[model samples]
Target: MSLIKLSNIHKRYGKGTNVFEALKGVSLDIEAGEFVALMGPSGSGKSTIANILGCLDSPSSGVYDFCGVNVSELNIKQKALLRRHYIGFIFQGFNLLPRTTALENVELPLLYRQVPKKERLRISMEALELVGLDKWCNHSSNELSGGQQQRVAIARAIASKPLFLLADEPTGNLDTKRSVEIMEILQNLNKDSKITILMVTHESDMAKYASREIVFLDGKKKSDTKEDS
Candidate 1:
C-alpha cells in the first residue's frame, strides 16, 4: 500500500521580494514498509521534504495524502494529532531530555497517548531493548555515549509504534563506525518490524543501504535509484 503520496508539491518561503522555492513541483510515492533515502546537497530541498513528511511544515501548494488522508489543509491541532499518532522522528541531534533517564525519555511519548504507567514502562523498556539500550535505562542522556544517546532517541521514536519513521541527517553527527552501527539498527527495524523508514542524508554510502534512493537537485528530483540488495 502507498503510505504517502505527494502530487506537484510546492514549498516556498518569504514573499515577492525575497522569495525562495524550497521544493519546486516535486511529486513522489512511498509504499508501506519500504526503506527510502532522500539525498541531495545543501539547498536542495532535502530538509524541506523531511519536514513535510514529519508534519513539522506544509507545502505551499500540493496534495499530500498520508495513509489515505489528505493532510494539506489540516489545521495545527489536526497536524499535531497526526504527528503524535502516526509519525516518528529521528534527527541528527538525538534530542533526548537532558535530565531524564533513558527509560523516562522513551516513555514520554507514550505518556502523551495516555498509556497506563505500568504498560508504558513495559513498552518503553522493550523499545530500549530493541535498540540494545535496556541496560542503560536508568542513565541520564548526558551520561550516555553518542551512539547510546541516539539509541535512546530511536527507542523513544518507536515507543509510540508509529507507522512511519522520518529521519533527517540521522548519522551526520556520528563517526563512520558509529554511523554504520546506527544504520544497521535502523535497517533491522525496517526489516524485522516492517516500519516504513524515510531518511534525508547527503552521504551516498548511507543512502545505498536503503531500498530506494531519490536524489534532489535545485529543489527537484534529479534521479531515483532502486536497489535489490
Candidate 2:
C-alpha cells in the first residue's frame, strides 16, 4: 500500500458567499521511501495539501489514506495520535526552545511520549548524530548558527523515528549556502535511512533535492515527475 494516498481531496474555508476553496479534487500517492516536493506560489494549494497530510486540517470532501488507514475519517484525538506517532514536522522557523541544549530540545517530543529518560537520550543523540550535530549537542540555540539551529530542529523531528518527515519551507530562513546544506541533510536522510519525506517549498532550487516534484497551481496539481535515481 502507498504510505500516503489522497483521492480527490477538497478543502474550503469560510461559509456560503465567502467560501474560499483551497484544494479542488486533488489526488496523489506517496509510496514508502519516496522524497516528494510540493511546490507552488502562495495560494496555490501546496501548503493546504501539506496541512492535510500532516493531519493539521481535515479535507472538506474525499478521502485521505495513510498506511492503509482512513485519516479523513479519524477523530481529532486519533489524528493527533497519528501525527505524534508517524509524522515528523520541520518548519521554516527553527522551533527549538531557547536556552535549552540541543540534546534537551531533541528530547522534548519523547518527553511528551513518556519515553524513559535513558531511551530518550539515546534516540535524541542518534538523531543528532544522523544530522552531524552530535558534537554540538551541548550547545544552546543561541550558541549555534542559523544552519546549526536548523539542524537541531531536524534532529528533534527525527528523534522519534517517525514514519515520515513533513518539512514546510525548511530552508526559508537560511542563506543560500545554509539552505543547500539543509537540503543535503534531508536528501541524505531520505537516501540513507529510507525516510519518507514530503516537503513544501516555493524554491525550485531546493525542490530539486527531492526525488520527485509535484507542483500545484490554482488548487490543482500542475505536474508530477520523478528524476532518475
Candidate 3:
C-alpha cells in the first residue's frame, strides 16, 4: 500500500463570498522510500498539502489514507498521536532550544514518548552520529554554527526513528555550501535508512536533490516529474 494517498482533496477557508479554495481536488500518492520535493510559488497551496500530510490540518473533502488507514476519519487526538509517534519535521528555523545541549534537544521528543533514559540516550546519539553531530552533543545550541544547529534539528527529528520526514525549507537559512552539505546528509539518510522524505523548497537546485519533483500552481498540481535513474 502507498505510505500516503490523497485523493481529490479539497480545502476551503472562510465562507460564502469570502471562501478561498486552497486545494482543488488535488490527488497524489507517495510510496515508501520515495524522496519527493514539493515546489510552488506563494499561495500555490503546497503548504496546504504539507499541512494535511503532517496531520496538522485535514482536508475539507475527499480521502486521505496513510498506511492504508483513512486519515480523514481519525479524530483530532488520534491525528495528534499519529503525528507524535510517526512523523518527523525539519524547518527553515533550526527551532532548537537556546542554551540547551544538542543531546538534550534531541531528547525532548523521546521524553514525550516516555522512553527510558538509557535507550533515549542511545537513540539520540545514533541520530546525531548520522548527522555528523555526535561529537558536539554536549555543546549548547548557541555554541554551534548555523549548519551544525540544523544538524541538531535533524538529529532531533530522526531520534524517534519516525516513519518519514517532512522538511520545509530546511536549507533556507544556510549558505549554498551549507545547503548542499545538509542535502547530502538528507540524501544519505534516505538511501541508508530507507526513510521517505518530503521536502518543500523554492530553489530548483535544492529540489534537484529529490527523486521526484511536484509543482503546484494556482492551488492545483501543475506538474510532477521524476528524475531519470
Give the number of the best model, judged by TM-score. Answer: 3
Clashes of 1: 0
lDDT per residue as tens, model 3, 46-73: 9999999999999999999998889999
Per-residue lDDT over 73-171 for candidate 2, one digit per residue giving the tens place of the 0 to 100 score: 899999999999999999999998999999999999999999999999999999999989999999999999999999999999998889989999999
Local distance difference test, candidate 2: 0.95
Taking the tens digit of each residue's C-alpha lDDT, what string does model 1 give over 8-75? 99999999989999999999999999999999899999889889988999999999999999999899
User: Which pairs, if any, clash in model 1?
Assistant: none
Residue 167: error of model 3 in Å? Answer: 0.3
TM-score of each: 0.98, 0.98, 0.99
- Higher TM-score: candidate 2 or 3? 3
- Local distance difference test, candidate 3: 0.95
lDDT scores in order: 0.94, 0.95, 0.95
Angstrom error of the Cα, residue 143, model 1: value is 0.9
Q: For model 3, where is the 10-residue window of minimal lDDT?
A: 1-10
Which prediction has more favorable lDDT, 1 or 3?
3
Enumerate residue pairs that collide in model 3: none
Candidate 1: worst-modelled 10 consecutive residues by lDDT: 220-229
